[model samples]
Target: MKKLGRLEFFWAILIVITLFNTFLGEQFASTALVSVLVSITVMYKGLVVIDYFMELKHANKNLRWLMRLYFIIFPSMIIATVFF
Candidate 1:
């Protein structure tokens, strides 16, 4: 197990992303598409944070399943609701 938290790595990636976003903002209109991509990146970074920062890797299998379920089930439910 890693002794150190993953915050440093997360912070670095967040900084890089922020810098890229700043660059984009300067040259681009910061449209909805760019916002969506940024949100996706944030979500991905969040998963890493959950695994390492929260030490979810050492947690019980059931809890892990529930967490995973939230990611899939919640979003699917929202989409289904919209379609139905």
Candidate 2:
């Protein structure tokens, strides 16, 4: 058997999360809890893609942080929109 590389592992995790998100979206009727869970997963998926897929982990500190900030801000925006 072959070992999975870091990118492959992250990819698998993203897939699993995507499937879970789909399930949640289908099963739940857009409740507060479902919204929060979806937001969290989106943030996590954004962070993972930023760090690994975008290869920003070893880049400039400011740039990396800026990318990370998008994930946080957008998810918060989602929660805000859902609530208000």
Candidate 3:
């Protein structure tokens, strides 16, 4: 079997977190803490995808910053929607 690279490892972690989040969403009522945790997890998953899957790690500084900003802003919007 092929050994997992750092990117693969990160991907695995993302999957595990996603599953855990789903379980949490199903088992517990939607609360502020859950919303915040979900938002943070979404941001983390977005960063991993941007850096590894999108090949943005070595991308131009402006592009990298733009994507990072997008991820942050998008999740913030989601959390805001949940709260307000």
Candidate 4:
């Protein structure tokens, strides 16, 4: 895995995400989905950008973890919707 350059690594991940979404939308479109479909896609893209482009793993440690709270709210809302 380390042998793969960063761009190659991200490309591989992109392929996997594409395959997953294609499979998911076909299999479960009529079923109760767990997440907002847009968020699902944005999650994958954000992760790639953070890891490959931003190089967050290598940079300073002061990550604004608070920003992630917005992402968490989606699943929480989904659960809330199911419960009440």
- Model 2 lDDT tens row, 1-84: 243488899999999999999999999898888889999999999999988899898878899999999899989887887767
- In terms of TM-score, the best-performing candidate is 2
**TM-score of model 2 vs. true structure:** 0.89
Report the alpha-carbon TM-score of model 3 versus the true structure: 0.86
Tens digits of per-residue lDDT, candidate 3, 1-84, equal: 243487689889899989989987999999888888899999999998998888898988899899999999988887897758
The lDDT values for all models are 0.62, 0.90, 0.88, 0.59
- Where does model 4 exceed 4 Å of error? 1-4, 33-45, 64-84
Reference-based TM-score of each model: 0.51, 0.89, 0.86, 0.51
Give one digit per residue, the lDDT tens place, for model 1 in 5-55.
456766687678778767766887756656555555555555666566666
- Regions of model 3 farther than 4 Å from truth: 1-4
Error of 3 at 26 (Å): 0.3
Residue-level error in angstroms, candidate 2, position 8: 0.6
Preferred candidate (lDDT higher): 2 or 3 = 2
Stronger candidate by lDDT (2 vs 4)? 2
Residue 41 accuracy (lDDT) in model 3: 93
Q: Which residue pairs does candidate 3 place in steric collision?
A: none
Count backbone overlaps in model 4: 0
Instruction: Tell me the lDDT of candidate 3.
Output: 0.88
- lDDT tens string, model 4, 1-84? 573586887887878777776777677753346345534665656656655666765565456243344445654565455445
Give the range where candidate 4 is weakest over 10 consecutive residues by summed lDDT: 62-71
